[model samples]
Target: MQDKTPLTPRFSYKSDRLKPLRAFCQTVRLGSVSRAAEALFVSQPAITLQLQALEREMGVGLFERSGRRLTPTREGQLLYELAQPLVEGLDGLESVFKDKVAGLDAGELNIAANSSTILYLLPRIVEHFRAEHPDVRLTLHNAITADGTDLLRADAVDLAVGSMMDVPADLSYAPIYRFEPLLITPPDHPLATKTKLELADISRYGLILPPKRQITYRLVDLVFQQHRVPYTVALEVGGWEVIKQYVAMGMGVSIVSSICLTDADRGRLATRSLKEWFPSRSYGVIVRKGKYLSPQARAFVELIQPDLFTRRDYDDSGHSER
Candidate 1:
């Protein structure tokens, strides 16, 4: 009854203990103390000390180390699950407020895109954005489409610009540009003389393709399989430029996105449209479902699609008729 007067808790909003919480969350998010230190602009020892202090205060081990990787324990996982969103919200609050007040003059925008998109599509967009908002920090993470989706899910990137064949349930994709698939061969190759090209015709020669693990390779494989065509992989290169280089070198022909084709390539290579043989690919910006876009991200997205933010046509599944 006397205790009903109520007790004041020792913890307060301005407590220094929250620093350790931030360190813990960053460590968990980055999956290593070194990475967390780099992101936080602190020393590795400082991050380690913060984690140790947090573990001591909580009386539990948070992370287990294996080789260079730091894996969260059950306690760590639970703590992260409960603490991450709050920490991010609090940390981003100042930027959000300033962005609201300043009208997109400041803050950071992180983008994930593959090498091809970065090479072909982003230069002009980035130039435009830079001209408009010089104060905003821009970071481009070079990741393939699959890895880009992973980055989007992890909140590592603000937005991703790439080609996605299958959209995941938790993500939204809005295509801004479409490119046809093309069969590229060296200027002197036998296929260069043929205007009416078919899958069977392309299959007769060795193909310089992206790695078999990539979606492009899978799409190529599926198209050839569906047509009952047998193709040989002479070399499995990584980038479109490399594939194009090899193709131009007369090593093998390649099926590549027309987005990668430019005026410079016209002189070195022979290109024939494969639109009938392969579906056109859409390169677009992908974002997480229910994600709150920052002012910078919103501005960039608007550049991609003027009505992307204003339009309510997108449903929970992230699909729209447009």
Candidate 2:
């Protein structure tokens, strides 16, 4: 009689842990066990079993049934946030490994920034990054905060360099540079000569400001509303340079962040600190949560702040393998 060969299992204990987690992540993402099974090309029963096993291991009910679809429980949602990245990183381990080996030699790094940030903040950083990594293609999209946030959510840009006042939960804003708010006017403007300025004093004059849709307008309005002070906007300009020119041309007085001030600006415009009344503005790196910074992206971010994105939360996780 021929000796029967013992069959080896397809998945090991280590792989067993990985499979269930992948299954769980997929079901949570796709919102259907059958859809996840089809996407992963696993049998429906196997997907259900894997999900059941995961729920047992996690010691919690992972899903709340909504008709045929499923929504993750609170605990399950949190677990998905943490595990999705891990699963993605492990799945793309081969390509990420290859990218690391390839280095930043010839990859592209896309960054989003407003005109103000590109004009005032990123020039030196961009110059140095270009000098160090000449082979890496760098493109900066001119985007306002809302547009930049949209680009980040769409993964159209790797990161953004700007200031954020109210950071949303899905994005991370780390302000590396701080600048005091300033009141700017032509050197001959009345308020420019006042030794001490008050919010009421500033409110008396028409202000030239960015369009009301911008954060600066929102912040200015917020401060005014909080203090019960009334104000007016003489002009709704788009760019800082235009605002400065309008102020310089004696169109109106305005408030701006000191980040835009240069020696040339100081020569033409009288600037006074409004920090006492207004909060300081910050400029820094803004990245989407769970982003895996590419080599080129990482290098540029490090130039901005050596210790930036080193937090435990910014763990280097790559994109979905599937």
Candidate 3:
């Protein structure tokens, strides 16, 4: 069998090898040496040695080991937080240099977004981009709010559009638009007759909500937690499409972003503003830290004209909801 013993713990040296820093950040984020090693594409021993050298240089223990897992010390946590953006900037710098040398013009753009963007934002942008660069292909992927950012980091997509909260270090974001969440129900649903609601009254019905970890769900939970309201979740689905369909079928009422609505859906589902609910859902364009945006991709991003809801061209563009 291969040797599994850990090598001697040597503290980090005062050298400028960024390898150790990268390893440290990954380990802190993932809480596992093996996982960090795999991410960095280095041997476990190499990663360990670098960390040891780094610890020696810093003169403080960075991590506390407990059986199989590793947790960052307070200092380590602080350092990891500071280093993430710096590392991402460095990665972006390197990519810019490589792109400068390659002399490439047209390339593909991979965009991942929630159905809301697919419905409200993409059509006009796609049309404008195609008119400018007919040769370049623009592909957009759709996911629930939770999975959008992960898909960007995993290289499953080049850019993502969704909630900007806790965006990863390896990604850059540009705010595109903002809107508020609304309570929606089938036109004849009990809540539709009313123009507004109190928390207790809304909570009385079975709720169709996004999973607790999802961004929208967090917002909803925060409101409930702050108001000390009790509510029952009848179903937790991942996507807005599913939620809308269920609400349309009279299964349950849903709290959804206003961007999820369309003219066709307006009559089918009655939307009521939640005055106490958070008034904004801000979405952005997220790209990998070091990836070069092709000329076409650059153009696409530039054409994403941000405007207030009253000024939106949603009616004329006819975007099909995904």
Candidate number with greatest TM-score = 2
Residue range 86-142, candidate 2, lDDT tens digits: 876788678677779989888789999999999999999999999999999999999
Q: Can you write out model 3's per-residue Cα lDDT over 89-162, one digit (the tens) per residue?
A: 46657655654564335456778887767878678778877787776667888886558777865666766766
Per-model C-alpha lDDT, please? 0.81, 0.84, 0.72
Global CA lDDT computed for model 3: 0.72
| TM-score for all models, in order of appearance | 0.69, 0.77, 0.73
Ranking by lDDT: 2, 1, 3
* Candidate 1 residue-wise lDDT, 68-161, digit = tens: 8887899998887666656766777786677779877667899999899899988988998888889999999998888988888677898899
**Which 10 consecutive positions of candidate 2 have the poorest summed lDDT?**
313-322
Off by over 4 Å in 3: 1-18, 64-95, 101-104, 164-174, 287-298, 305-322
Least well predicted 10-residue stretch by lDDT in candidate 1? 313-322
Better of 1 and 3 by lDDT: 1
Question: RMSD in angstroms, all models?
Answer: 6.9, 6.4, 9.4
